[model samples]
Target: MKKFFKLVGFASFIGILYYGFITYPKLDLISGFSAKSIASGHFIDHRSMEMIEKGDNDIKMIDLATNTIDENGQFATASVYGLKERKAIYREGLGATLIDADFDISAPYEVPKRTKLVSDKLFPYGNQEAKDTVFSSVDYAKLNAAVSNAFDSTDKKDKRTRSVIVIHKDRIIAEKYDTGFDKDSKILGWSMTKSITATIFGILEKQGKYDIYKPAPIVEWQKDKRKNITTNDLLHMNSGLEWEENYSTICDATKMLFQAENMGRVQLEKPSVFEPNTHWNYSSGTTNLLSYILRNQFKTHQEYLDFWYSALIDKIGMKSMVVETDMAGNFVGSSYSWATTRDWSKFGLLYLHKGNWNGEQLFDAGWAEYVAGPTKGSKGDYGAHFWLNAGGKFPDVPRDMFYCSGFQGQMVAIIPSMDLVIVRMGLKENPEFDFNGFLRGVIGSLKR
Candidate 1:
């Protein structure tokens, strides 16, 4: 019996060694990459260091102190503060770099003016001047109660609501934040970045730069079976690419997010497992691929940066928004975008106004309708990139509602019928928060 136990222990040691040296390298890289990126973004955006440290508690395989360095000291070393799992470099000019494991490939990166641009213009709402008119029509008592409940964590262990903002008729009606967060805090919008990617595509389409119905301009698929796949298929997540979206393990999503220096190239190489536009599989790879295609539309990185700035961010006044790029310098549309709660609301407002901001059409005419319209592959639950409220998914909310949903309970729900936009951002692994019930409560509180 003692011999048997010793053998079992030896076997366990071998398994650990195999996983540590082989299977776990990607996972470790993902953790370090994410931690370094988050730390860099926070420091660059002037976020609280204490809050940033606390946020790292939920991530696996992360050593906050070792992985993160002071903002001034990050650029001096090849690795971001001497982190393991390859050299995750950080530079003041280029944010965090997800270096390849072999250290052979890294994209030419530049810090665009948009990254440092902050409009000095005052916000339309949330200031003392707008406060008087913003909540005048809202039921003060009921709206207050609803907003309070959204931020409350009385009996729920996983209900960490960071920020909640309710905009009614284009005015901020109610807003609340958790202890460590505020209106100015820029929160990460994981999968919600996909919707933003779709918007960028729509803007390009408006300018006649590309067409979704045509074959995607991916050189890899030019001679392959995937050559027939259209930009529309990628936007709808029906590109038929075989992608494992598992976040708990080191799957395609993690590989694209962390290990791959050229995320688009990694995803583009994926062979089709299903017929194009025939199946509805949520794929971060498709989004990243779309971002890559978008990048190709421009001759230089500066042109791409200028387009994003002048086209979307500047038009909607999303001044606090920051979209990060992979090592290949393509925006990681699948994940990695940060915006304040109000900035998220502005994004929702753009959708609520049918892709128009202040009477200027930011995208093609009827682009909003096309995006919110249900995809046949999704059975009315998902549109182009946004999640739809159709198919009885959110029975309490109007069927016309569409949302930008992200991992860990981030949402920017736009209810067009009600002229309402609700923004909720949080960091909960298993969310106990009820978005439907919360939206219902907020709608119920409206005086109209």
Candidate 2:
């Protein structure tokens, strides 16, 4: 009996060693190589994208450029890259990836190095006054204390935070990044892309595009009752589309991220879950369909990027922005937008000021009000693509606070009553969010 037990133990030890030392090293090698491509400004292959969608490395791609691989294994200048999203964040390297990748890559065109701090102008919305507020600085010590307390109280071990920035009255009041990362890191925004997508649609409405009162511009709806679905319903997550947002490997959401070539199109093909505009089901499908509509409306990716950037991101001077691409090259509107911490703050401030920054009306005056209005799910408080602060009567924070939150922990909380914008970025899974606690603490710590 003793000899049998000894043999079993020996075998188990060997197995563990093999997986830890050999298997993990190989996995890291692949991840490392993918990281190299990002650093070198090379577009990562689909296989790499699959790895990221599975949350294998925590590192995800924000941009897919046109590139050709040759016999010598080098990327040339024929490829032109377009900025896609507003704030991009990386998953792995635990903040180590950005710096490491930066050191290795060589590009022909002057690629705007991803940094923690970025500034750019948005179209028709651009103004000198807005630029000033977008670049404002904050009190770091007090802000750090708040974030540190929030993190320490959490139980998750790998709770990595890449960046955090706070904005007040359109000025960046505080900005910070984890070790091994600076303002240039293009971290993935995950579902936060939904809010950004909503912004684009808002701009489209301003441009005389389809009105929210009318049926959505989806082609599939014209033949069926889905035609009753309105753009307003989609924006409020009330499209009644059938979709399971489960992140399981085979679930529709994960599959869209990992396996589907045209994520937006795939969602459009799915049937409805409930009556249009009646119920609120948090479906990525609505955002995906929005992408399809944008693609159908616009001529090309560059045109879409140009229109939005000139009108929105560029106006606010947000740099580190890069939107992800689907297999069809359309911006993945559901998930995947990347940017630095500071750049994200710019977005938060833009919305906080009711689409007006530095004396310029970037978005329709009603845009912020629409986003801050609640939806059917929240008993009429969560409106459009943003989340409002409910269950009021909290300290330091006002009852009317709202925010644009993304997967992991990318957040842009806007406290309208307090004239404050709080941005937090990190990795935190659902059914276990520590953000509310953090928000409470931050409000508690604010200088009274």
Candidate 3:
């Protein structure tokens, strides 16, 4: 009897080992794709290396082999436990696309017919060329010290600030970058892509292509309880979709990002866990689902891409911005966008100016207000996709300020009261940076 029990225990152990062997490849592929995408999108080698090392230390149950630059040196490929390799490549206009072991790489989106290429002309804020008159009311010494404090590291915390850009009254007053980074470096915005996605929805609404108050046009939901989910509910992150956003495990987020061919399909398959608009859960699945709806509105991928560029990025002078697509050609709108610090600041400026650029209204009237307005479901901490400062969440900062927040301490804060846009990008774990204090210091330094 004892021998029989021992045999059963040994068999269970073997099953566990086999399961680990099979699943480890998927985890490794996720890491490889993440590192390679950052490398190719940003055009940085050392940063990619640093990302891989950090990922290894962060996620358990995986072994990453050496990541190598492709023969052309424009892309990167990596393997897991010396098998099940994955590669990430950068397209010309689109950002990084990961090709994993099981992914069916789709044909590139066709270029649009109305491809009026905007010239990369030098603007006032381009290359940090600000007018002297713009700084006439500013305290240069105090502002410099405030910016310096953002980069300072202490024994208890690491700032790890890669770049900082301060725009006051539509002019770049101060700009700084780490040793290897510069104005042209394409830094990933992480979850801040959600704000860009929301902006796209606003544009579509202006063109009569979508309506936020109406029911979301998802075919699968037509016969189910999810059919009641409105576009506004999804934007407010009250979609009632059952999703696990955990990155530490092989959950919905990892599957949608690394394994799924169609991100939208994966999200749509989720069962409704609660009545729409009753509960508030921060789900990336809802954002990707929104991306799916946005894609289907246009006839083809070209029309979609063209609409985004002509309607938003080009008009705002965000020349370096790139929004990446998934394996199935759906924009990973929940998390993948890259742009320079200056370009990011320009995005903030657009919102600060109430969606008008140079006297032209790109977004509909009240669009910016709607985005910054607090969602009733989120307890006043969130808007459509933008994080709000309502309810005095940041006691030091103004109650009206709103911002695009992202993973790893990426922020593009907009203060309408101060006519200011502050951009800060960084990569840090266990961040000890005080955002409210930083904003207060910057505001206090102003000589207005």
Q: What are the models' TM-scores? A: 0.87, 0.70, 0.86
Task: Show model 2 residue runs off by greater than 4 Å.
Answer: 1-144, 150-158, 379-381, 391-397, 429-433
lDDT of 3 by residue, 1-448 (tens): 9999999999999999998777764755555554455445445323555554443223344334446665464566666555656677666666567766665445436542233335443343243455455466788888888888888555322677778999888877888987668988878888988999899988778778788999989888899888999999999888888989877667788777876777777778899998987787887878888889888888877777677777877667777777777777777889888888988998999899888877777788699989888886787889889999986777888888999998777999999989999999876522366777777778877865
Using lDDT as the yardstick, the better of models 1 and 3 is 3
The residue-by-residue lDDT of candidate 1 on 1-448, one tens digit each, is 9999999999999998986676445545555555555555555456554555566334554432243445554421123234343445565434555565565334445665653334443344223224445455567788778778776566453667888988877777788988767878878888999999999989888888789999999877888899999999888888888889887767888767766778877779988999988888988988988888888898988887667767887667777777777777777788878888998998998888887776688886599999988886788899999999887687777888889999888999998888899988886632367877777788887756
Error of 2 at 298 (Å): 2.2
Q: Pick the candidate with the highest lDDT.
A: 3
Flag regions of model 3 displaced more than 4 Å: 1-26, 38-65, 102-128, 134-137, 153-157, 429-431
State candidate 3's TM-score. 0.86
- Candidate 1 shows a clash count of 0
Candidate order (lDDT): 3, 1, 2
Q: Rank the candidates by TM-score, best first.
A: 1, 3, 2
Tell me the tens digit of each residue's lDDT in model 2 across 1-448: 9999999999999999975564332332233333433422323222233333333244433123322233243322112232111111232211112122223333221112232323354321332323433222333565668776544234444556656766665555556676545666666676778888888877776677747778887777799888888888888988887878864224567556544657787768878778976788777767877877777776765566455556666666665566655545566677767676766777888887777767877678787888888888766446787777664423335668877778777788888766788887776643355666667666654554
Query: Clashing residue pairs, candidate 3?
Result: none
TM-score winner: 1
